[model samples]
Target: MLEKDRFFEKVIDRIDHLDRNGLKNLIENLQQKQRVLQLVFEALDEGIIITAEDRVVTMNNVARIILGYKSRQYGNFQEMDKYIANWGLWNILKFLHGEEDIRKEFTIHQQQEPKYYLVEKRTIEDNLVLYKLVDQTEKKKLQFQLKNIESVAALNTLASGIAHEIKNPLTAIDLHTQLIQRAVQKNLVCLDESILQYIKTISHETKRLNQILNDFLLAARPRQLKLSFEDINSFVQELLLLVKPELEEKNIALREEYQNIPKNFIDKDYLKQAILNLIKNAMDAMEKSSLKILTVRTWYDNGRDSTAIEIADTGCGISPDQIQKIFEPYYTTKEYGTGLGLTITYKIIKEHQGEIQIQSKPGEGTSFTVYIPIHKGHKLLDRPL
Candidate 1:
């Protein structure tokens, strides 16, 4: 037998000879150890699930949350029938029932966003099977965003050059057309009414093309941020005040929920432009809706060391397909939209090393959240701007 087995046996043999005090001390020691083990189990970040040889199932709170199990514990696999049926874990549990170890990742759509988990199943002592799960959602999102930023940078570089080439000709046409119109008005030239109509058409088309090019340049070009420390809540409040008249004119109900937030290094002009574009889009979306409500919320997450602004509107919500393409250059659903508003907003956030998150449902509502890092004086003292 092992040393631990011999020690246990010796203790068991001496148990009867021990007095009441000795027994009480031994019980207290065991209880303390049991409590410590429970604390460690609950404190773990990974989800833990253990199944005994007799088919009894034990799980921690994290495991229960990951599996969407509402109960405390399960006596057997049969006790998990309800969750197994709904969670699509029937096959996974079945495979886990076997002797071999299995490892895989699962992507579960939970309400607004999809969550990713890396699950590993292996056997422990006494025929106890253990399943460990680690959340991988944030890791996946960061990887995807990095990849997207690279691709967008490449595309914008190419598009910027083309837009620059086209702008010169458009500007020339616009200016010369204006000169001709001036000459005709001054009676220095004679033209038919049909020719005048053609001139008007050319001028209108030229100006429209010029506006599109301007928007494209704004969206694609790199900008240097004029960083300054400002209170996020106050910044949002001032912006709401600027738009309050329009909101009142359109009978749109406005709500502001501002929590205490830390000041951060930001470009006031760029950030304001980004938020204004989102607010304008929200108002446009609600113009046809019977119930119009716009909500602006600002908060700070100390754990993330970031501050956030969320703009939610009760209007025509975006479809899943449109949400994916909403930030793409020149992709717009509005008839008169230049399609570069969100793109510029995205670019501004990216320039600040920030991120934007959006959630929407068809016929429901949409929320756009912009997150920027919280900066402190000491942290930025040695760090480069």
Candidate 2:
């Protein structure tokens, strides 16, 4: 027993007599390691929350950001849960408290904009659970947008096939109707005014039907772009001139805000047609309005490496519900609208590897913005001035 006591005394004496500077260095190293671990925790994109028993040990910055919690370095899950319950995360806390590990995707709709999340939980030790969360809102939105684009493309193909089959039959009907009308007028048959009117009506209706089918066909088929480098500003000026007379007739004021920008690679004919259709639609929307104004603006978007043309109208704006479906095929608000014009415009912009977006507020106005890449196969400097 005396030898054992001597060994314990020596061990205590050795630790007590350790070098001061060496102990200081060891302490500094340990503090540095803790700082590095904290930095790594904050840098992670995934949110991490760790709890010891009922108290919160720590939460990373990412977790704080994703959860919109202000206290990052100092807060317990229990304390966070007190306020975070408003964010609808209380159920997740309950899951963490359970015995089984948890992995699930859930949506929080309590906020202004719904958010999606993937939550994973595992028991780290006695009565401690580690929860990892990923904000999947943007990722899910992208997936949904991709799915919509694929659906629209498939529908366009189906519409093209159906439209192609009906074209020839429609042409034959129209030709026969015209021939009957001509025969009636030529006195080939003793037909009354009513009979002649009926024949004329058939011709008119067939022509209208043919126009609708033509629109679908145009949207469905792949377009071979006749790419020409042209000044977008000048092209837009030329287009406005064609619609000036119509605008004046309706007492609609046309405002132009044109900026001198670089030339763009585009299919001149296709782009012109698309812009004209938008202008026509704008004019139609303003026909019944007391205050009519059309604004067209052009500028270069250097960030996107494209040129933007925005057509805005102070006419009847589209409803929020209808705005989402405006580009959908066969969906229209106009009485005689084929609902294919905007769809075709969308397809044209997409073919040029561009983007089109619309903003509208009911009873206020609407704007359509189109972005076309400035360079396709040619460098920006090489293009004409």
Maximum-TM-score candidate: 2
TM-score for candidate 1, please give it: 0.59
Give lDDT tens digits, candidate 2, residues 120-192.
8888887777889898999999999999999988887887788888889989999998888777678797888
Model 2 off-target regions past 4 Å?
Answer: 1-15, 18-32, 64-81, 86-89, 102-116, 125-128, 227-268, 285-333, 353-385
Worst 10 residues of 2 by lDDT: 376-385
Pairs clashing within candidate 1: none
TM, every model:
0.59, 0.68
lDDT of 1 by residue, 154-264 (tens): 988998899999999888999999999999999999999999999999999999889888888888887767777889888888888899999999999999998988888
Residue 380, model 2: Cα distance from true site in angstroms: 14
Give me the displacement of residue 327 in model 1, in angstroms.
10
Backbone steric clashes in candidate 1, count: 0
Off by over 4 Å in 1: 1-10, 83-86, 108-115, 182-189, 224-385
